[model samples]
Target: MESDSETHSGEDTTPDDWMDLAVDSPDGSPAASPAATQKPSEEEDFKLSLITWNVDGLDLEKRPERSRGLVKYLNLHNPDVVFLQELVPPYVQFLKEQLVNYLMIEGGRNGCFTGMLLKKSRVKLVESEMVAFPTTKMRRNLLVAQVIVNGQKLCLMTSHFESCKENTAERLKQLHVVKRRLKHAPDDVTIVFGGDTNLRDAEVTKVGLPATVCDVWERLGKQEHCRYTWDTSANNNKTFPFVARCRFDRIYLRPAIKRGIPRLAPDHMALVGLEKLDCGRYTSDHWGIYCTFSAE
Candidate 1:
């Protein structure tokens, strides 16, 4: 990874300051094949499988052998891309070695690292970056990637915003900064944002994402199975012991075309990683959300 470029300010930086990056496609493959750049035919396959998780700050010092189990758990799901928050640098290095099928890209600071892993053959990483917002004396970031996924250009990002309940304003600030930062991204690609926003749905919308975006869980009619993404009493990687559950973790999307909106597949939540171990510790404090999107 290149040394991350950064700027500190209480106000917006020019669109050019958003840290747009260019990286070779995974394994020296061309960034976009000829077939990939062509106009999509109705027959073109634009399906994407994604997973986003917060490992509760898993790092080498915190849990040295945890990457082994995480690799096993993540591989089982067969995700095309995995977005992770709070995965420290050292553990990321370890997973890069173990999860040979996926390549790692990460960002963030103050121990709130965000990472994204893409299954090498399914997607080509065209660009990757970390957009930071220095607020409340701590820096938060939005980890982003521009990729060619199965012939469709897509921009996917995940974030870990301000955490405490009292820092709602700070969270709102971080939220607005990221929304503005993405305005300069490639205009024609599908965009997907997911991960722990650390804010509830209502609070999230208050930050005002473009009207085109919709929370995938709610857009799919807030199905019964995924009604609650965060819960204290029932989940394995427990946090906020007394905090009642809310849909804190979520996935949001903006379709590629005005009319050809991708339809989300059924069975979006894959909570298997939350299963307990022999010692009764859960795989992670929160369950990962998995969804398949098909370009119509």
Candidate 2:
């Protein structure tokens, strides 16, 4: 559990806020070959890939295998940035030992919290900070990081949000804080926020996003295949008796509005961690979201 000293009081705001394992390759497919670095021609555009997931770190059972499963996905996707939720000390430690290629920024020092992993070769870290959710009963906070990726200034944010259907009000408050931060960010920085939001479609509609920001999944046309990220009927990892499906995990992009700063647009989106691990358990109750962006 987190000590009180670790949590900051929430601030009043409108419209703002803000893993690994083991075993075999889940899809029985070979790991993706790394893309060779090439200097982009004038006609070529810079590309960025990101993944966000809730690894269920608090479960404590079969964690090593589950952590290994996460590693496999990281290897497979080789994303430039990763947003993680529900991360505990041991789980974060394992990832640190395994993923030497990433520069990790943790939201909290102890207990379950959120984190960010920036690929060392591609992302140059600028700064990071955490914004506490003032009324959260779950100790939720927003983690934000500023980095330079391929000469583009990018702001990355992540959070677990307030959980459960009953906590909608607090969740929306947290969402507003996130929106304010996004709305206030510098015009030259493109921002990407992702995590286990624990949000329903209706709740998002109630708060509304900023004019410049768009949900990555929706921007990519909201394909049906990747719509439900927390489908109990298919995942079966939580062993809930009743069937339920929801898109609790999501990613949102706010492109830079400044002139001459290349704008990044969503190019592709997919869900990850669909297959069961060698231990016969899925990587998480929620499927991870993988997305690609092209700066044009």
Candidate 3:
């Protein structure tokens, strides 16, 4: 993985600057909103929408404007749950101010870390905790949130695994930790994990997801349009002489196995942040993955 100095040379503030602001609520309670009062009928099928993105908070150029663009996209999509990686303190503050209808949970307070946003109206947070990687050189860790959506339990997990092609071993170890969590989760709770995994296809094949789990992109027929999340050729936010494309950002789903709970199926998948902002830069160096699941 690239060191902090190498990847985030533009960063001006120290980690201590945002330590106090990073405290999460005791119960992860979200403020009441108008939408919270409206409940769906029991007979109606429930749909869950999610978005996962690496917001590239390290880059300080056009930072404020870029954050506005992110808010615009989030408002436009209005996902029920969101998994965000590469989050810095300032970016988290900006999101809290703009996204008033979401409950924000930080994975770590210092440096760049991961976070989860649960919509105030649709999702109810039960608890949240972070699992640290024992040998992570980049301070990477897993952020897990237990949430309730329409009375059904869901385990939401997000992480920014060790990056760089050279750190494949470390990335694999991190992947194992995630898989173990999924395998041990209660059978009645569905598991949904998404983030910038920084994994290669071969590595996933080697570790292999649980039998109940399925890669959202692969389960949806691997549509070419949204296949590559980290495509330098398409996103020009970072200047590079050579073009590169990789599916670094991904989502995995493991539906509840116990009977009674409705199974969530992957229904739609698409990429966001494709358009350039007014400042002539994309939302981030990597595209965001948007997906919808229908309870069956």
Give the distance in Å from residue 26's predicted Cα in candidate 2 to where it truly belongs.
Answer: 20
Compared with the true structure, what per-residue lDDT tens digits does model 3 show for residues 7-54? 122233433433333323356542233343456455432889999999
Q: Itemize residue pairs with steric clashes in candidate 1.
A: 237-285
User: Local error of candidate 2 at 223, Å?
Assistant: 0.3
Q: lDDT per model, in order?
A: 0.65, 0.82, 0.84
- List, residue by residue over 1-296, the lDDT tens digit for candidate 2: 23232322212221111022322235843333243243434433388889999999888667777887898788778888899999887777667656766778888876688988888878888888887788888888888888888788999999999988999999999899889988999999999999999999999999999999999999888899999999998997888878999999989899999999999999999999999988899988889999999976
RMSD of each: 9.5, 7.6, 6.9
Cα displacement (angstroms), candidate 2, residue 127, comes to 0.7
For model 2 the local lDDT of residue 189 reads: 90
Ranking by lDDT: 3, 2, 1
1-296, model 1: which lDDT tens digit per residue? 22354411112221221112111256753233223234434543556778888776543222443444466566666677888887764556555555656777767533557788887767788888776566644456777788887666788888887787788898888778666644544556788888888886667768877765667887777787676667777774555647677666778787655344343333344444556654456556677788877654
Worst 10 residues of 3 by lDDT: 1-10
How does model 2 fare in lDDT? 0.82
Worst 10 residues of 1 by lDDT: 14-23
Query: How many clashes in each structure?
Result: 1, 21, 0
